[model samples]
Target: MNKTICSVPAKIMRNVVLLLTLLFLTGCWDRQELTEMGIVTGIALDMNKETGEYILTSQFLRPASQSTVAPTPNEPFILISATGKTIPELMQKTNRNVDRNGFYPHNKVIIMSEEVAKSGVLHLFENFQREQNIRSYAWLAVAKGTSARSLLEKHKTSISSIPASFLNNLFMDANADAVSSNLLNFYKKALKKGESPVIAVLSIDEGVEMTPQTTKLSGGAVFDGDRLAGFLNERETMAYNWVKTKIRNETLGSYDFLSEDGSIVALALIDKNAKINPNVSKGSLDSFSIEVNLLTELSEHQPMKEFNENADIIHYLDNIEKQAEKKMKADIRHLTETAQKELESDILGFGDRLYKRYPSVWNKVKDNWRAHFKDLEIEVEVNVKIKNSGLIKGTLLPESM
Candidate 1:
């Protein structure tokens, strides 16, 4: 019994010694300090037309003390551009201008110039996916009528001391409103065989002295396979958002309840869901049916009026439904037409749907999926339900009435 107790104590001492040794040996293997790294806020990619080389632009956040403060102090974001045959080469060139190592873990946005996007982006995007430091959930976008370097130069506004934090917050606000796609969503779309990738487009318009810098979320850029085929405007993007079940809270245009001239009543969407059903016919793809349900509440009313179950009120609701439906359908049609006729790419995951529905048949048609998508038909249906009308029963009725 004494021997047994002595052996147990020896085992405990051995275990404790082993744990202490491990603790002592285990130091930060991959730890980096902010001072040792250049925090990349944004990246821009463009193809040089003259040399047929790739231009990679990166916005590195400079410490406040390093920036010029007087004579119209430029923002803390520094724009560096380098040209190379590949992205890695360009990145090496970017590192030459910076004191610290360029790190992308804090990268908020990746802006692909229209030229690079149109030339083909799969290779560049693939590199991003493979990188260990880059975040998979960073926001991706395309710039309009501007080089990636130019876009980075225009990001002079910083809401906080940390420019990277401010830029990230801006994208978060846009994502919540369904105006942009986050990195994870972009990756899924890019990897899906049947669906073409879509990215948010950022358009910057330089302003005069008084006018503030105009940063507009232009639309969605539709990619066919690995190349950009077309773009959607803001309205069309809204429709695309509806199709993707991305919208959180948005005002679905206004309706006149009592009178056409009365204050327009608008419904704010609280929740939404979208589903796509693909139907096959005669061994060929027939059509895709998209069903969208929106739960909304009355957010704003023009003239306060008492709640009534009158015919006019019912008619107003019907009209609102029709108008919203029409707009939504038009948006879907625009995307479909752009994907089929213009881009000749199946930006909508119709190919994946086909594969899931009929795998054996999909194998036969996968090679010519774009051709099949062109011949496909698409239908959209929107169902919106109004739940509550805020604090007021209705808009305030005119005293004269």
Candidate 2:
């Protein structure tokens, strides 16, 4: 036998290796170029009660065409919607109307109709995670008083070649300031037990038209498991963000700073952190304590009060801290009470905390934990640090010596 001779040809082996390397290195097998693909910016999910079907609406960035070169009387982007039993089914229906395949990798937002959210969003989201290639960081929101399809169809703004980019930027800003939860955070909270998930809610205000955009984030939606449990106003949403330790550089309204003058002052939250400590007593849950630490800088001052490091400043800060503490406590109390009584679902991830702190206990109590949660006592403590007083040491009011 010729031991030095190879059974297979070296040239064939080399070609195989080259082909394998190319296959692994470049994933261009199904890749499509920008010109060949349609970019989906936003998606809307609505439920049809009559037929128990889902209406999926998508906004696609329309490519430049000869007819659209000059200017169009209509919007730049095109809206397409389809109804089916499932998302994939809807996709098939959608493909019939559009020339290019709907690509979702760059999709910015997922809007759920209130009815759809109330009916159940878990299945829709499961599909999104399993079948769709949308980024985990995209924004998730609820559309108010209308079907998701309506929100998608009403487009009043125009962007240069990319209208969705503008909407994406708006959501990014909102999420950064703790105004809303991004998709990643929403999914994380939603999946966890003993905690409820929340998403920013978009609505169209007939009274005000800030932009040509048809939809705006008015408040936020609270979810118990996969169902829409309740809605939070903008202020409550801000407070919820603070409790979740997600606030950054957002203005928090001041309380009683004007000393009976009834003026309002606002401070920008520079940094904030919140910790939830759960304690078990007598083989049952005793209480959960939430400690919130906030560092803020003065953004707006009213009645021109002075803020020195002296007794006056200390007193003012003390009052401000008290106000903040009161507001935070109220917000937490409302959330807890509502989650326990009205929703009967945990959206706050208390179960995760329990599981982490006392896994053995949680294992025993996990089944009927909702009943126990309602009786669980909760304490909230807020510590606010006024890092900066802005340009002046205090306000310019004549009341201050």
Candidate 3:
């Protein structure tokens, strides 16, 4: 018995040591060395309409000189482009221009030109989706009125060394009017039955004199089954964003209200609560009612009148709120009509909402939701409340004036 117990301990020790030796001898066969990799910061896909070929542009991080201990920021990137029939072919061509292997984990954004977007984007993204190295969180945008390569080459970056990073950061800004979407989120919505993807629109703003050319994110590109269907202007984009999301720190826009002379009020949205209710009766859809309640703070106003009395200030503020509500309602109405009548696309998630609430109803119209969407009746209600008028109760004009 004693001998058997001793052998068991010895066998356990031998197994443990053998496992340790195997682990120590193992090598990382798939490990990638930094020196052999070229970090890709951005990618732009454009198409030659006449030639029927794709032009892929890749922005790579230019390595800092090894001689400098701490190198200052310089031209931090270089653009390499290639043309081919397929994305894989373009990538292979791009690889010949650089010494190191292309690495995509650090990639910030992927931009597609209007032409490419209009044609279709699913085939282009297939390679990216299959490649395990490419990140799904990379942002996607559509360049409007310019080629994707031109925007990548020209757009000036102030905060980030990589222009792609700069473009990605633009979506985080609360004041941005465009809709924000990443690769994974885009794919999810693109493949969804009732919903569609809305990608942010990037454009170069030409500067006339003292101003330099800058990048602007003002509108959104609407998609229907991977093909670009239409676009939403800045105002319509803002309204759509407000309807889809809860607003915090977003400025809805300036409103003009007549309160004892012409007064222009700029309201900053503090909080928003939005609800989309689909009306259904006897297994048939009726209409969708969108109710939006907003709490805002007065940011600026052209002081056309003085409000010294409490009653006068109260009356003036009430009128401002009413006018603001009216304007917001009209904006929402216009946006809905544009989506239904002009675009014939369901950029809004009305069908998705209906699906989640009443799956049976969605099942009946799933195949022909597009036709239903174009004729769908949507009602919008907006309520605005100005919580505060900043430090001063009335106009900042001096009493002497």
Candidate 4:
């Protein structure tokens, strides 16, 4: 009985020690409350001519005070701009001015103005690369015709709780024709070899009366190495998407086909796939053969022609498929030819393909690939299948039929 009592006293002493330790470690030393930190939703980068410094703009979130009351006609975000030679210095200045410490972990978008991009985004990229606290996958785009700050100011009313959440949703819900851009991938391509960086384009457009302005995200900005080379239209971007981007997974591309009487038919592109083959002859790069195949459904047709029978319908579908194939082939050709002739750069990533598929040939030409790419020849073939006619099965009885 004496031994049992002694053991109980020892156990009680151990429990007391554990409780004291837990008490000591209860609160975090670097604890930060949600209300205390100003969450950054978006960032815009530009160049300041007068200051000869970088213009860094940040969009900070201001959540509603009461859940039931509608937020005062005030915007859900506050946009701030500070000019500094470097990002670190700019951020330090920003911290001193803002009411709360700015947090970037929740950032949604990064916009680089066309002028800033042309000058070289190396410094901006370095900061993003070095930062460990924030997401590396913020949706990156280049703003055309206006400042990045202007675009951010206009890109609102997304209906998400936080500004960051709104931008993330906006990008996710955006049309799939353009490939999404992120910091890491863009920089990796900019720093390394073989491929060029292409960023989605954002531009401000006039909205309805109440909204006043809106942002358009389409097309793309192409970089020859690290410098902004040229802009690609939507058609050109579609061609690039087929060869190098994620278009096949998400978008049902549309094409216009001219009818016999000068009218048009609209077909929706679907289930597309591509195969590229590189040929070499006599120890010199010969040519590249690209084959593209896709399925399409007819959405709208002109009133010019009426299909009289099943054979006529088949003929019409066949003709539509042929036109689509031709259009895709022409588009790919134009993109490659432009890459080779006008841009004089391999933005199509043929060098990387050559490196992978034909390492031996690449080893010989990798150093001078850009020069060779300009003069390189290519053969393209596109095959399209008309899947359906969308609801209208047969011809409307013309009363003559």
Candidate 5:
């Protein structure tokens, strides 16, 4: 009787184990196949100022017939648009009409038109923030002088079949003409810290007859708490990059000097360092001082004067360095002044820096930081070092020769 009872228990335990094993053998119930999803490479958001409705445009990647990776002359994307009161609503409506589910993990860019950027953008970001499929590192841009959807539709490429890839490649250069930022950092700056954010500007270049239109990335859209305040030209954008220490080696810089016979010197940035110091007096924020140092290689010297001696070469470079410093300082000053006087936006993060060093003072002014920023005095100092001139120290053909 004891052996029979033990056998019954063992059989029950075996059956339970077998049932658990069968549960583990089941396949994923919600797995989506590659063919069942449409890969979105780019998204453009715009607002109808009159109706206040949101217009969402998405670029879906269409794989090449033969080779998916090879560059093709034909455009490999289709533009789909939807309209609704909110971004999420528009996204849902778009999905209802599309054959394949919209997959957004591979998205490379999001462009907001001027209308939407100027009115406000916080609502649009909330949808993107809540969506887990969208990548946080995808670049953000503001469409300039055109609708976001039109820019997306007009964007043509020869480098790669996907225009989004071309757009991503445009921002990869160290000498990028505009500020580069992503959704995560940008949203954090605006929402978390209550700081201003700047996004790169995208514009379409209508090609000449028989030529294809191309896209251009230049300048930046400066925002004051998620609303477009103003714009930063290419020079100002470079200055902004310098202050933020975003500049990298091999980046190009050029400036013109009237004293040097109206000559223009081109330079390649070799290295850079920046120091932003905030002045606080008696628990009160007073001013800020920014010092930037740059080591640069002389890429082009417009003055064709040859240096006959070492002393002459040294003098030439020293004068050029001073002019470079002056040019850079002017650009930086212009950007700061615009931020304070015109835009009333702190794109340079002066207030944020102050908060880090003296939280007490920042707390007092955080509510009205823009007012303080408008009046706050900032001193800009730039020191440029020309380490070497490429190939030749001076011009090959001299006037005397």
Candidate 6:
């Protein structure tokens, strides 16, 4: 009757619950700290021919030393290397030599030796995809005729304090086409039936020590399936960009040509759109047509005769537009021929366009898309308009030569 129930007190139960909660609050088991971990901002992969091993080069940031020092000529970042038979093994081996666990979330770029890329990057990607720390947006590039290790070496300042940031800046330049070589992006495109993958080409100037601006990211490395097929030069790259996207800033690199008036001239593209349309006839792949509209401004017009009147300006503009159109078409044609005949890869998303417009036709050629894309007839038409002529125009010949 005294209610001697065999029950625990509320106070004891509260204490038990608190102790269990405390056990679970031991923090993330795998969480790494910045000070205790090597903050990797860039990574490069290479293959050693003699040893037949995979080489991993990692760039670690030392911000504490950089800002606190007198800014001597020492590298702000430290590069470490390790070799293994595979990418995952290589990474594990590399970590053994490092003072701390190599953290990759901050990695801005991944450079691969040409040999590594040609052999196929699927294994490399496979390991990275499984890691939570790896970034999807980190750029991927192929080093031409050089070890990826050489590129990561601190030979010179590439403008940025760290080489990794410099690599990021090189690819992210506004004047550039704004395309990323991020592995995730490449993988997505590769999986698409009508699209192939392309990564940026990183070339270093061997003439002198590479300045921050010395490393060039002008062209692209095209891939067939998962293996690299070949490369596209700067001009062809520009053309490919045009065919693939609308101008973000409309600025193509400077163009110089001989004007119709027998004078040297130069122009800068400001903005435009490159549109591709695939036409099918009778449910079969027929042809692809491209229409581009461009707005250009005169950068330099060294006319033999001055623009003394508005009509002269009109005449010069017309001649320049025609010349520009011709050059543009030529570039596009060269790119098309190379992709079709030489590379035998569909760098252009033409197949994707075809699939969208003509799904039935796409199904027929989807398996052998590159073959059909190469054989598909294509036409291009470019229209350029000159809208500006600088702050003031004319020759400095004292008004009467």
Q: Which stretches of candidate 1 lie over 4 Å from their true place?
A: 1-23, 26-34, 64-75, 154-158, 161-164, 175-179, 206-210, 247-265, 281-284, 300-311, 390-401
Where in model 3 is the C-alpha error above 4 Å? 1-16, 65-74, 154-157, 174-176, 246-261, 391-394, 398-401
Name the lDDT of candidate 3.
Answer: 0.82
Query: Of the candidates shown, which would achieve the greatest lDDT relative to the real structure?
Result: 3
TM-score for each model? 0.79, 0.82, 0.91, 0.87, 0.91, 0.89
What TM-score does structure 4 among the candidates reach?
0.87
For 1-401, candidate 1 gives per-residue lDDT tens digits of 99998999899999999998998787698888877988888887888889989888788876764556543355566777888988778888999988877998778888788888888776776677777566877887888877666656644554465434555565666642235666677667777678877777777667889877755565688877567778877666666666664544354333223334445666666677888887777775668888888777766656545756566566665665666566556667886787678877775677887788888768888887767778887887878777764543354656577
The local distance difference test score of each candidate is: 0.71, 0.71, 0.82, 0.77, 0.80, 0.78
Collision count for each candidate, in order: 8, 14, 0, 0, 0, 4
Model 4 has a clash total of: 0
Clashing pairs in 6: 158-212, 159-212, 250-270, 250-271
Q: Of 3 and 6, which scores higher on lDDT?
A: 3
Worst 10 residues of 1 by lDDT: 251-260
Per-residue lDDT over 104-199 for candidate 2, one digit per residue giving the tens place of the 0 to 100 score: 888887888888888887777776789767888888888888777666564455243444565565565574222456777877777767677878
Q: Give the runs in model 6 whose Cα sits over 4 Å from its true position.
A: 1-26, 69-74, 155-157, 174-180, 208-213, 246-250, 303-305, 391-393, 397-401
Sorted by lDDT (best first), the order is 3, 5, 6, 4, 2, 1
How displaced is residue 146 in candidate 2, in Å? 2.3
lDDT of 6: 0.78
Which stretches of candidate 5 lie above 4 Å from their native place?
Answer: 64-75, 154-157, 174-176, 207-212, 248-259, 391-394, 398-401
At residue 34, what lDDT does model 4 achieve?
Answer: 91
TM-score of 2: 0.82
Cα deviation of 382 in candidate 5 (Å)?
A: 0.7
Superposed on all Cα atoms, the candidates' RMSDs to the truth, in angstroms, are 5.4, 4.6, 3.0, 3.8, 2.8, 3.2
Clashing pairs in 5: none
